[model samples]
Target: MRLTDFTELMRNEFGTMASDSMLRDHVLSDLGNRTGAVAIEEGVDPREVWLALCRDFDVPRDRWYLHPS
Candidate 1:
């Protein structure tokens, strides 16, 4: 799938403020599932997915560890 479509799916699935740790866990938990089911579906490394999320949301990588709920 296209990056834009993948990004939108990430946003929709995770919500606006999905925590980085949560994202990490989500990806890990679903690692065996179809690639399209995870955020980095297009062979993007999980770290890259987290970095992209941090960049897009303007959240510092360090701050992403804090629990949002």
Candidate 2:
């Protein structure tokens, strides 16, 4: 998926508190190795690997720590 799509997905899934830096760090720290492996094995973009993760995890695109009142 595109970066915009991924960004939107992350915003929804992890909430507004989850900044892009946080997401990048989390992905690198948690899924970097596995994602790299999968990307290499599947010949897909690393970004796609991350997208698959969000999709597989059923992460919402609008997850919020606190719903607006």
Candidate 3:
């Protein structure tokens, strides 16, 4: 799961919009608080971030593999 994959997940769920960036930023920031390791600072695993997002938002498990690439 790359950043592009994560962003694509956001687009798939939320549709295309500039607000997607804000949503991503907000989620990532909150993730840092919850995990105690900022992704950018320590290079968090993308799969971990994705799983955390899914758990935090209750996203459907079916969509978990919807990442395009």
Show pairs that collide, candidate 3. Answer: none
Lowest-scoring 10 consecutive residues by lDDT in candidate 2?
A: 60-69
All models: lDDT? Answer: 0.48, 0.48, 0.59
Q: Write the per-residue lDDT of candidate 2 for residues 16-67, one digit (tens) a residue.
A: 6654544443433344444434443555553555555555555564542222
Instruction: Put down candidate 1 lDDT per residue, 10-31, tens digits, no spaces.
Output: 5654675654345544433234
Clash number by candidate, in order: 0, 6, 0
Error of 1 at 4 (Å): 23
lDDT-based ranking: 3, 2, 1
Please report the TM-score between candidate 3 and the true structure: 0.56
Question: Of the candidates shown, which would achieve the greatest lDDT relative to the real structure?
Answer: 3
- Which runs in model 2 stand beyond 4 Å of their true positions? 19-21, 27-47, 52-69
Model 3 Cα lDDT, one tens digit per residue, 9-65: 666765767325434454554565643125534677666676676666677899777
lDDT of 2 at 5: 54
lDDT (Cα, 0-100) at 15 in candidate 1:
71
Which rank order by TM-score, best down to worst?
A: 3, 2, 1
TM-score of each: 0.34, 0.40, 0.56
Candidate 1 regions off by >4 Å?
Answer: 1-39, 64-69
TM-score: which is higher, 1 or 2?
2
